[model samples]
Target chain A: MRRLSALALALVACGGGGGPTHVVSGVSPPVSAPPAAAPAPAPAPPPSEDASVEVGLGEARLCVRVGGHVHCRASDAHGERPLLEEPAVEGIDDAVSLSVGARHACAVLRDGGVACFGDNAHGQLGAGVGVASSPRALRVKNLASADRVVAGPLHSCARVGGGAVACWGENGEGQTGSSTHYAEAARELVVPTAVAGVSGAASLALSRSVTCALAGAGPVCWGRDTTQQPIQNTPPAAAPWLAGATALAGGGEAVCQATRDGTVACRGSGALVTSMGPVALPPMTSFGVGASHACGLLADRTVRCWGQNYSGQIGRPRSEIGTNVTVPSAVPGLPKIKALAVGGYGACALSLAGELFCWGSYPGAPREGGHEPSIVAIR
Target chain B: MRPTQIAAAVALALAALLDRGARACSCFGPRPALVSPGPDHPAPVTSRVRALVPIHRAAGATVVLRPPGGAPVAVATASRSMGGVDLVELTPSAPLAPDTRYEIALHSPGQYPSTFVFGTFRTGATRDVKAPRIDAIGVAGAHANPGAMSSMCQSADTVVTLDGISVSDPDRDGAEIALGVWIADAAGRVDTKKLPVYWAVPKNGHVQLGRTSICDPRELPLPNAPAVTLGVAAIDESGNTSPVKLVRVALPPARHP
Candidate 1:
C-alpha cells in the first residue's frame, strides 16, 4: 500500500486576503498582525479539498494512527465548501497536544511550551509567536512543563506535570475558572483537578465548559461540565460504559473516549451544539474533537468518526449524506494512517504508512507540506 | 318582525351597553347586548352589532363567524351602533357555510385594509379537530459548548401527512390539528410560536429543534447553567391538546452517573 504523504500547511502560503472571514456561531476573527517587513511575502495557498469516504454517507477530513504523529488541514470548510487551506500555527514547532476553539486553536509542544493560531482578540492564540502566515507559537510564561493542551471558544487549558491544570485566553464566562482576565503560563487551574491518582498522564481534554483526562484504566473530568473534561486535582474515572481507553477528546458540548478496548464512547446532550447518539466503532485506538464531531483511529490504521460531521472533519462533507453522520463509521479510500486531530472546522492526520493526509479547510500544502520555500525563523 | 321583538332587542342592547359602562369609565355611551339574529329576519338583515371601542379605537375588534372555510363572502357596513364608538353593524350578503370557516373584516376608517377576524370558527359542529401526532424527535447541528445553547426539534410532518393535519380553529365545529410549543428551564419558559422552528428537509419537513429565536415567539435564555427541558404539543379544533411532548437535555447529567 502506498503510504499517504503527510499534508503540510504553510501559514504564509495563503497571503492575507481581504475576503470577509464569514464565521458561524462562536468562531472569532484572526488576531495576529502581519509579519514585520523582512523575511518573505507568503503566496496564496491552494484551498483545501475533500474526498468522499463513504457511499450514501458523509466524508471524513483528517486521518490518523495510534501512537503516531498527526497531519491536519490548516483550513476549515463552511457547509460543504472549503474555506482556508494550510493555515498557520501560532506556537512552537513540536506540538505535543493540539485542540480547536471557537475562534482560535492551542497546541502544547514537547518542551512544555504553548502555541496558538487563528483568532487572538481573546488572546486565545497566546501572547507572543511568529510564522509567515500560520499563527506562530508564543512562549507562555509561568510554568514550563506543559504536557497537554485543550481549547474552548474563548478559553484554553493545559495539564502540567503535577496534575495541576492552568487555563488562559478569553475569560468572559469565567470559562478559565478563575475570575481573572489572562494567565500567561501553566498555573494551578481554579477548578478542581480530576487527575489525582494518575500522577503523570500524557493527555487531557477540554470543552466549552468542561475538561477530562485519562490515566491508566480510569479517566476523570471537571469544570462547568457541559459534556466532560478533566479540570485539575481529580481522579481518573472510567467513562460510564467505556472500559480500557487509551486517549480522549472533548468538543464544545460532547466528549469521546478512544479505548484500549478499540471502541470509542461518546456522551453528551442532544442539543444542536452538542453531538448526541451512541456511535459504534470498529476496534479503534484514539480519538480527537472538532467543533461538533469526534474522529477515531481504527485498528486498520484507517480513521473513523461520528457526531457533528461539519466541515468534513469527520473525513467527508456532511452534504455527501445530508444531515450529520453521528454514527461511528469508516472513512473510505484512506490509505494507512497513524494519528488524527480535529481543529474547529478542519482536520489533520498523519499516516504511519508514512504519509500525512488532511481534508476540509486548513491553510497549507495539499500534499506533504509541498517542498515550499525554507521556513522563516521566528523568535 | 313584531314591534315587541324589536323592542326586546333594543332593550337587550341597552342592557349590555349599560353593563359595560360600570366596568370601564369611558365618555362613550353604554354598550348594547348582542342578540343572535332571528330566523324571521331577512337573508341580509342588518342588526345593530353590540361592541365596545376604546376611548380611542379598539385594538383588535374583529367580526368572526361560527364555522370556518368556504367561498369568499362580503359584509356590508350598516349604521353605526353607537356614536363615536366607530362600531358598525355587519350584514353578510350570503348565508355562511354551516359549521365551516367564514370571515368578516372590521371596517377601520383609513387604517390598514379591512381587518379580518384572525381565528376560525365553526357554525355548529360537534367535535373539535384532532391533535396531530408527534413522531421521532432529536437535536441537530453543532453541540452546545460553553457560550452556546443546545437545540432540538420534534417531527410532526409524518403524522401530519398520514393524518392530514391542519391548523385547528378554536371556533371550527369539527377537528383540525394545531401546533403549540414551550421550552422551560430552572429560570423561565418559552413557546414554539416564540422560538424559531425550522422546516426539516423535504416538504412540510415538519419542525426540527433550533436555537434561533423568531419574532412573535422567542426562546428564553437558559437561566441555571447546564440544562433545560423542552415541551411541544398539538391542539384540535375542539380546543383539545395532546399531552405535551417533553424532553430534557443537559450538559451535565442531572444526577451524577
Candidate 2:
C-alpha cells in the first residue's frame, strides 16, 4: 500500500503544459460490509468500456499517448516533456500512434504523416545525416503519408498510403529490405526508400536483425539470419501453417504469425506450440515478441508468456523459476490487459483502465526492477 | 691414455668454457650520464635493471655492494619478450642504501660461467615515488574497411584499437610500463575486469598502442542508454598509479531490418 507523497506528485507536473495528468492510486485496505444474515444479494454492475491510452517503451525512456499529444520521461533525467515540443514539430497535435526505438521515437499523425525525434547517428530520424541528433520531431523526408510506422533499434519503416512499405537508417543486416548488403550499400539512408518486392503490406514488425510484414498472402520476412532461422531471405511461402495468418510478430531470430483460427504459429528458434507440447491452447488475439522471448494475449484477457526468462523478462522471477520458461505460463498478479509490449530486457502491459504496468530489468522500476510486475506512473 | 690424446681433450674442454663466457648475460639500465643531480640532471634517475638475455632464474640473480663489503642480497626477477627483445628485470627486496655502489651478477649453472657480473650501478640520494604521466588517449578500429561506418557501433562486441596512448615517466626508472583501461556505463557501473597492456621502454617519445574488443557481460542487451565512458591509467616502476584519463563515446542503437 505504498503511496507517493504529494511533493513527488507535484514534481511530475512541472515539465509539461496543462493537460489531464494521470496518477497511480495507492492500494486500498479491504472493506467488509455489515453482515445482515440471509440478506438478498445485489446485482453485479456491468463491465466498463476499455480506456484509450497508448504507451511506448524505449531503452531508457517511456512515453504515453494521451489527448492528441505524447508525454515522455527518461530514467536518468528528471521530469517529463512533450514528445513533440520541438519547433520542427510544433502546432502538430493530431498524434494517433507512437513507436519507440532504442534511442529514438516516431509518431504517426492523424493526417497520415510521420515525425521522428532523438538519435540519428545512422539517419534513423529520417532527416538525413546533417541533423545528427534532434530533440524535436522532424517530418520524414519524401514520405507524404503513412498508415502505420514501426521503429526498431536503429532503423524505421512505415506503411504508406497504398500499403507500400518504406524504410530508412542502418541497413547493416539488410533489414531495410534492400537488395544491397550493408557493406556494399550506403550504411545510412537519410530519407526513406521503397522496400524492394514488397507491396500491399498490411503491417510491419521489426526484430534485432530482421523485418517482417503481413501481406495479402501471409507473413514475409527478410534480413540477416544470424542463426539460420526459417524467416530468412524472401517470404515464407513454403510453410503451410502460415497461410491464413492475420498478424505477424518478430523476435531476435524468429517470427510468429497469429492465424485467423485464433492459434499462433511461430518459426525460427522453435514455435510456441513445440514448447507447450500437446496441450490445448486458448485462443490468442495478439502476440508480443522480444529479443529472446514471446507472449500472447488470449481472448480471455489473460497473458501467457514463454521463452527466455533471464532478467525476469517473462513476467516471473528467474531465481524462482529458473532461466528459461519453455511453456506458456500465466503472469500472476496482473489485471486483465488490453495489450502488451515486450522490449529487449523488459515487458509492459496496458490495463483496461488505462493503467500501465511494467516488469523485468527495464530502468525506473522499483526494487530489483525485475522478478515482479509493478504499476508505472506515466503522467 | 696417451699424453697427446689427453692434451687434446683438455683443450676441447677449455674451448667450451670460453664459448659460454662469450654468451654471458649483459644487463643495461639508464645511461650513467643521465643520472647527474641538481640542475644538471640529464635524465631521471631509476633503480630498475634490464638484461639483454633472459636470466636463468630469480634464485640465481643477486645484487651486492661494491668493494665486497656487505652480504650479497638475492633479488627477484621477471622475464618478458617485447619489441623483438628479450628482457629480464631485477628488483631488490628493499631500497638500496643511499650513496652506495652495487653490482648485479647472473649465474646460469650449466649454460654460462657462474662468476659473471651483468652490470654495475650507483644509487642516488633521491627516491622517485611520483606516478607516470599519460598525456592523451586515442582510439580507432583494428581494420580499415571502406564499408564500416564511424568506428564505434551499437553492438557490444566491437573491437577497437587504443593506439594513441601517450605515456611518460619522470624517473626513467623502469624498462617496462603497465597500462590499464576500464569502461563505465551510464549508470556509473564500471566493468569489473580491465584491459591490461604492457609496453617496452626506451620509447624515445614513441607510444605503443594496444587493441581490445569491448564486450562486458554485465551490459544489458539493449542499446547503451546514452554513452559509455572509457578510462586509462598508467603505473610506474615505484608502484605509483596515475590519475585516470577518461574518454566518452556515444553509441547509437543498431538499426533493425
Candidate 3:
C-alpha cells in the first residue's frame, strides 16, 4: 500500500492523472500518445469473477466483460487510446456469450437475446439491411434463444437453444448458410437466418470463409474453402480430417481442433503451420488460432504455440521469431490461463488470477511490444 | 446508386477497412504512423493526413516518396517526441503537388540499402472532392456471352473471378478506393447489400479482385428470369461511383426445372 501510494504520487507529479486514462495492458502506441487522450501505464486489472475477453479474428479490437459490463478498446492509426475508459459498446451488460468478428462483435445476452456492434458493412450487426455500423450494441430481430454466438470476418452466427445456429450478414460465400436471392434485402440479411443442415451442434469454429460445427455427426464445414472453393451451402459437409474434435478455433485458412485423447490436430498448409508430432505434445484443453499461427492451453495451464512467427504471434522471443516458426513451441512466461483469444497476428491469455497477457502486437515496426506476454490492465 | 446509398456504402466500407487496417500490420499515417509492417504491408493505409510520416526508432532511417508517374518528392528527416513514442518523422521539405498519389520507400538503417515498396498514401485537399475512375473490366469464370445471355447458361455456384478490372484515383491511392461486386437476377434483385466493399488494389494496372463466390447470384425466380447478372463498381473517398460493368451469368436449362 505504501509503495503504491508513492507510485501514485509520482504519477500525479508527472501529470498522469485526471485525463481519460485508457489504461490497459498494451505497449505505448507506435508514433506518439493519442491526441489529448490520457493513457495510464498502470498495473493489471484486479482479479474478479465473471470476467472474460474476446479478440476479433484477425483482431479488430479487444473487449473485456467483467461482471456483465463490457469495456472495449480499439487500435487505430492515430496511436493509443484510453480503451475501456469509454465503453465501446454502451449498455452491453449481462452478456452470457460473446464472439468477435474481423470488424464487428456480437454477444448472447442472458435473456436469450443477441446484440451486436461495430462494423455492419455486410449487416453483421443485424439491426437492418442498410445499417452501416453501430456505436451502441443493438438487439437482433427475431432471435431470442441463442445458446452461444460466433463471429467471422463478414458475418455472425448464434447457436440457439437447440443444436441449430442462426446467422446474419454477407452470404457472398454462402457464409450465412444460404445464397443471396439477388435482392437488396437478401444480399445482407437484416434479420437472423437459421443456418440449414447440421443440428445438435456442440460447438462452432468459424474463420473468414469456413464455418464448422462439431456435433454428433463429427465436424461439418461449409462456406468457401481456403482456395476459394465453394463448399456446401445448406447442409454442411463432414471434414474427414476434423473427426471427433473436442474444441475448435480457427483463423486465416486453417482450422485446428483438440481431441478428447489429448491430441491436437491442425489441418492447414505447411507454409502456414506445422504438425505437433515427432515428439508427443502435451494434451490440450482449448486453443486459439491466428492467421498463420495457433496456440493451445494445456490442462496444466501452460501454453504451446506453432506456425508463422512473422510478428511473433507464435509467442517466441523477439530474437527467435524467424527460427522454428513452423515448429510447435511453448510460449514461456504465461501464468495458468483461464481463457485464450487469438487474432490474425496476436494472442491474449487471461490468467486464473485475473491478469491478461497478450503477445504478437504489431502496433508499429514489427514490434507492438509483447513479443512475449505483456500484461494488459483490463480495468 | 442514390446519394443515401453512396453515403452508406462509403461509411460501411471505410469503417470495416479502417478497423481491419488498424489491427492488421504496420499502419502508415500522417499524424501517428506505425512502423515496420514487416517485409510487406498488405493492409492499405487509410489516413488522409499528409503532413508527417512517422517511423519508430528511425535514427538512421532513410525516407523516400515517389509520386505516381512523377519525380520523387524530397523530404527532410527529423526526430521528435509525440505521444511518448520515439518517431523519425519524415516531412516533405517542399510543398507537395496537390491531388497526387505517392509510393513510399523507407529504409531503416542497418537493413539493405535497396528499399522495397514501403506502401502508398494520397496527398491533396483536406476534404477530397474527386472520385475514382475504373476503366476496364474482365472476368475469368463461367459466364454467358453478352450476346448469348438467353441461350448460354452457367452454374450459379461456380466461383467467379474479376480479373483485369482497372481502378485509379488521383485524389486517393487505389488502396483508398472501395471496390465491390453486386449480383442481381433478371428481375434485378441483388444479392449483396452495399456491394460489400473490400480491400482492392491495382495490380499491373488491374483491380485485383481475385476470386470470389460473392457473385453467387441466386438461382433465378424461374423460367421468366432464368439468368443472374453481376455488376462491378468502385467507390472513391468521396463516395463517387465508377462506370459499372455488368456481366450476365446464365443458368443451365435443367436448373430452372
TM-score of chain B of 1: 0.34
- lDDT by residue (tens digit), candidate 3, A98-182: 5666667777687888888877866778765345677689887788887567666666777776667777775545556643311
lDDT tens per residue, model 2, B85-146: 23345555766566655544443333212223333445656666777877766663222223
Which one is best on TM-score? Answer: 3
What DockQ score does model 1 reach against the true complex?
Answer: 0.01
Give me the candidate number with maximum lDDT. 3
- Candidate 2: DockQ? 0.01
Error of 2 at A106 (Å): 1.3
What is each predicted model's overall lDDT from 0 to 1? 0.37, 0.49, 0.50
Give candidate 1 misplaced runs (Cα > 4 Å).
A1-102, A107-111, A125-136, A171-199, A215-218, A226-246, A259-262, A270-276, A316-320, A361-379, B1-257
- What are the chain A TM-scores for all the models, listed individually? 0.57, 0.73, 0.76
Tens-digit per-residue lDDT, A1-379, candidate 1: 0110011111100000110001111111111112253232223233221111100001112211111122333233332122122233323446544444555545556667666555554455445322211344455545477654555555566667645566665442343443232221111111221233443433455555444554333455544433335422212334443334344455545555544334455554332134355455654434555555556555456767665544454565455643477566566656665445445444445554434455544444233321111111111
State in Å the error of residue A245, model 1: 5.0
Model 3 agreement with the true structure over B1-257: per-residue lDDT tens digits:
12232232222212122343334322222222223111121222322212113324356645555653246566655443322222333445554555555555444444321232333444544444466677776653443223322112212332344566666766645334545455555566554434322223334544422221111111212233345576666655434557666767544444322
Cα error, residue B195 of model 1, in Å, equals 39
Residue B184, candidate 2: Cα error in Å is 45
